[model samples]
Target: MTTWDLAVVGCGPAGSATAMGALRVDPTLRVVLLDRAEFPRDKACGDGIAPQVVDLLEDAGVRGVVDGHVPVPRLRLDRGAFGVDRTMARPAWVIPRTVFDQRLVEAAQAAGATLRRHRVRELAQPSSVVLDGEVEARTVVGADGAYSTVRRALGLMPGPMAVALRGYAPTPANRANAQVIAFGTAGQPAYAWSFDRGDGLANVGYGELLGHRHDRPTKAQLRERLDVLLPGASDGGTGWKGHQLPLSSGRWRPPTGRILLAGDAAGLVNPMTGEGIYYAVATGFAAGRAAAEALIAGAPASAGARYARATRRLLAGHLRHVAAAAGLSRHHRVIDAGLRASAADQRVFDDLVELGLARGRITPTMARGLARELAGAARRRPVRRRR
Candidate 1:
């Protein structure tokens, strides 16, 4: 049996990014990437990448792909009767997961990581994954998404999940060059987004915290609202998809063996916004580097634990901050008020998505700006002019 340096259990952005980082640290280490689905697979996602993600791609020797990313600069946010419009000069890209995930996988292969297409049926720890009852490696990375098999094998329990649904459509002219976020006041925290894909197409989706309802809107009911929002593009829409975002950051303990979890497996996605791609990619890189260092230091079994500690150090505070924000979002009335106040100043909207660029916490400047705007809005309103 030939032993390999690492086996990555998923081919998503996180898995591929980790493999690339590992190879960068030690080019000679043999890395294998395994995934149940093949390249170019479609995933239900908002498909927007922040500029910071661009930096990570560049660091992984993938600048060419980042340069080719589709741009969406204007952001429009709505919460009930209040709304705000903002332009993003820093740049955000709308790269479909199909194209984006494939490129990352190919990049990993080009960087010398082996690609394996097989559903990972099991993970027998202490050091091995049973993929289709076969392939095995000394060290493993579980980048598999929500409900990750690797996480399960490691006995890592995930926290509550955020359910999201999305699909592709013809880019409406009115929606071109901008993205839309509509917040729901009553129910399981619903929000619909429209991101222009630049190729005469757009990605539109709705996300809500699962099992909580405000107005009896079923999945179909909420989707119908989206259909109205996107207009002509929503007609003949056959692509209905949904996925879960694991929010709890899980147990923070990788299995007591040479297996580490990355991406959704590690529950790194933000609870409030369902944004995990960038964090997953960042943590995956950290994991890969830690694993490679462990291997080079002649400590294979401790690699998993080392990866966990490194990932926690890199993300624990950020996760806590995101959780606080998400909790606020759940209180719809307060968030709605915030959104109304934010309309006068767009930085509040920017701070929401740009949390990644801000290193997870909203800056004091942004916080003070938001506070002033809210206070001013409160002062400006006529004292209950009841007609």
Candidate 2:
């Protein structure tokens, strides 16, 4: 039983990022990276990296991997009678998870973290993780996504979860490089997307509130809608995959235990956008920093609590706004009106950016302006027309 200083379960962006962060913070620290699957494994995702995530990775020295992929620019938002193409001046990258996850793991390995491809069976307190009949590590990190084993071991399961379906399609030569979000295609409250990855291929998928199924299309059915939406890229067959996202921030209580959680294991994904890569990587970096501080300086083991507090400071307002935006989208009419309004003016895009900066969520300030406009319209309601 070679007791290690830290054992990280799951080698996705979150796990690898955390390992890299911890090692960078302390090169001498012994960190073991473990994943149930082998390298180049696939995870269901839209595969589009927003600009914010790109910046974070660059600061973390992983920008090369992100830059190597194709750049995506505009995000086309749509609903039944509403459609808008919002320009993203900052480039977005589209990369296959198989390549991206492996690259991150390799980077972590280069940073002095040992890598292991063993399935983690169980996790125990007071420094121990059971993987392949062996108990290893003085500390364990749960980066294993929504159905997180580390979280389970620590009695920190997510109370609410979201189900998502994703896949890839062939991109036509004529189509523009853009990320498309279509709502009300098959029903209300559910939406599908098509992301041009710039390799004569695109990523297409759909997600809906769990248990809120209507006459909407299933993951497979969305393929037909994809064909209707983008005829040029619809000739190829469909590829379908599914995954789960946890909504709650998981348990941050007693953050000073022998086992810690980060990324999806901690339910750190954005509640509205279904975006988790940046948040996961960010959380991973923070967790690694906290772990390193605990190990090198023998600081109060409550470093994870500090990390959680920092996460809230950085993301709570944005997440709350996400929740509010998601609520608004639940209404088909609102979705239609929002998209239609955005298409009419680039100001909508500017407002969205400002709102995200102001409150942390991707909200369009145009909505508030539109409300004011409506109020003004009511004020001039022909005062002499009293019947």
Candidate 3:
């Protein structure tokens, strides 16, 4: 058995990003990347690559892959009765996961991390993982996704999970540059989205929070809603694929010991926007740096604590707001009012967009909007002074 310095399980964005970050910190470190599937695998996602993802790719030296992707400079928020198109401060990209993930894997291999195609069966302590056999390592980073084998083997219970259904549709020539996010309507407790893929195609999807008041939509129901929202968008020939999104609602506990967890394995998805790519890359970077420093200090056991603290510092405030917003989402009327306000006020719309991106902290603009809404509601209340 060839002992390695570090072993990263799962070679998706999180895994590849971890390997790349770790190797960048220490070129001499021996790193092995493992995954069950081969390269160019397709993932069920809306494929909305946010600006933060582009930033991470650039930092990882993989910006070349995004060169030909469609640039989405604007986003339309639709709430049935009202809709508004707001220009994004930083443009996003619409790239299929098959292309995006493969590029990350190649970038990791280019950074000198060895890539191996093998299914991980179990994980053990003392920095050892069992695939075909027991492979010993000084440290292990689990970047596997929501239903991670590492997380399950380690007995880490996740928080609320969201289910999403998505598929590709032929894009209309006139709407090739359009990106739309539509809120749920007619008793549906989810949201739908469409992103133009820059190749006469669009990725359409819908997601709902499980265990909510309403039942999860069926595949046929999801397609039906997509057809209604995005007229003439879906081909109605291909089937929609569903995936689980593990949301971090500030209740998830981090793994302890020489082993560390990152990305969806750690339940780092945003509770509000269902955005995991940014958290995946961010946590991967943090885990890699922490693991490297711990190894260099000859205290591999401290890696978990370091990673936990770093991730909390990076995600605590953001997740706090996400949890609050998710709570507000439970009230349909509140969301409707907020959407109306956002559509009418550009300042409110920009603030909401910023909040969705997690780029800014709570600001006065948000507070003012809430206050105005409350004041208007008070004025609309009927008086009972005669009694």
Q: Which of 1 and 2 is ahead in lDDT?
A: 1
Instruction: List candidate 2 segments past 4 Å from native.
Output: 127-133, 173-175, 185-188, 212-235, 248-256, 344-347, 350-359, 362-367, 370-387
**Candidate 2, residue 369: CA error in Å?**
3.4
Per-residue CA lDDT of model 2 for 1-387, tens digit only, reads 677777889999889988988888889989999888978889898887767766666787775787567788777776655577777657677888998888889889988999888778665554344545574665567899988877776766574566666767776554458877766555435666777888877887766656533433465555555555555444564567877777643223325555678878988665556778877787787777767766776653555666667667766776666666667666655565556556666776655543332235554467664454445545756678668
By TM-score rank, best first, the candidates go 3, 1, 2
- Pairs in clash, predicted candidate 1: 187-214
* Tens-digit per-residue lDDT, 1-387, candidate 1: 446789899989889988998899999999999888878799878888878887888867786665565677877777766777778657788888888888888889998999878888776643454444576677788899998988887777887767777788877777888877777656567677888888877888877666643433456765776655444545555577878788754234455557777878887777767778887788789878878988898887788677778767876676666666667667755575556555655666566666633246655655666567557656877797779
Worst 10 residues of 3 by lDDT: 125-134
Q: What is the TM-score of each predicted model, taking all chains together? A: 0.89, 0.85, 0.91
Candidate with maximal lDDT? 3
Question: Which of 2 and 3 is the better model by lDDT?
Answer: 3
lDDT of 3 by residue, 245-281 (tens): 9887745557876788888898987776787888788
Top candidate on TM-score is: 3
Query: CA lDDT of each candidate?
Result: 0.75, 0.70, 0.77
The deviation in Å at residue 165 for candidate 2 is: 2.6
Off by over 4 Å in 1: 67-69, 126-133, 212-219, 228-233, 249-256, 356-358, 370-387
* Sort by lDDT, top down from the best: 3, 1, 2
